[model samples]
Target: MIKQDAASRTIEAIHESVRTYLKQGLTNEQIIEKLKEENLEPYYIETVIDNIYKEYEDKKNLKNAILTGSILVIVGLVINMLSYRLSENMNSSAFLLFWGIVVTGIVTIIRGMILYRS
Candidate 1:
């Protein structure tokens, strides 16, 4: 029980320190040196760094994707409306293409939300 408690605290400490260093915008090498000084195992340090970096990148990418998807949807709609107004003879084929673009954007947004949640 005592060993488990110690291990848990160690893990928490490592996570906290890593997050702090990340927030400070320290480089990877500086973070590694600081972790080594804290007497953390090399393996734990590497794993934590990789995990944290991946997590942050995933979230960042997800946000960008969602924004891009929304933009695509809006642009598709605006173009469709303008085409309809400016060219009264906008044919079925053109409408279908615009709808396809909107659908693609919606699908992209849904996928991004799923990834962000997970």
Candidate 2:
């Protein structure tokens, strides 16, 4: 039991190391190189690295999508406001484009949130 406990702790430590390296903004190659010194099986290292990196990338992408979406929505609203202020009867095509930007932003944010949750 003692041996098993020690081994489990060691495994957890290794996993934590991977996360730490990732948080430090190390490149994938750098992380892999660091892991290579741990005497782990190549496949094990590859699997762990891939899974962690994928999660990180997904999170990053989701954040970017939400931010980009929000900016687009704000820009659309501002443009719409300015257009109306300048001319009460704005061009239909211009309004259409602004509305489209807002819709696209909404879709992007929704998709990002959904994908992150899943």
Candidate 3:
């Protein structure tokens, strides 16, 4: 039986090889040659490709979320600032700021829920 560490190492090697092939858009035969040059087993390339694709998708989703949240936060800040100028009274300004914060929180929570549910 293969030791767990050794199996993990082999999988990592395969994963790296798959990433290389994807980056280079290489054929399976070419990928095998590349792996051979690196002294890695090429037979596991398909498994690696599958794993890498899933990893890429996960990373992409995370990146998109960060970008969306950042944009929304910036927009919320701008809205809060502008609301102060639009309101003449101090109480109105304070209320606008409070509502702006509440809106931002709600939007962020909704985004989190949507992402988590999916």
Candidate number of the best TM-score = 1
TM-score of 3: 0.62
What are the models' TM-scores?
0.71, 0.63, 0.62
Candidate 2: tens digits of C-alpha lDDT, residues 26-99: 87678778888877776776777787778888999999999999999999898878776656565343433369
Pairs clashing within candidate 3:
none
Q: Rank the candidates by TM-score, best first.
A: 1, 2, 3
lDDT of candidate model 1 versus the reference = 0.84
Name the runs in model 3 displaced over 4 angstroms. 27-44, 88-95, 98-118
Task: Report every candidate's CA lDDT.
Answer: 0.84, 0.83, 0.68
After TM-score superposition, the amount by which residue 99's alpha carbon in candidate 1 deviates from its true location, in angstroms, is: 0.7
Q: Clash number for model 3?
A: 0
Angstrom error of the Cα, residue 76, model 2: value is 0.7
TM-score of 1: 0.71
lDDT, residue 93, model 3: 32
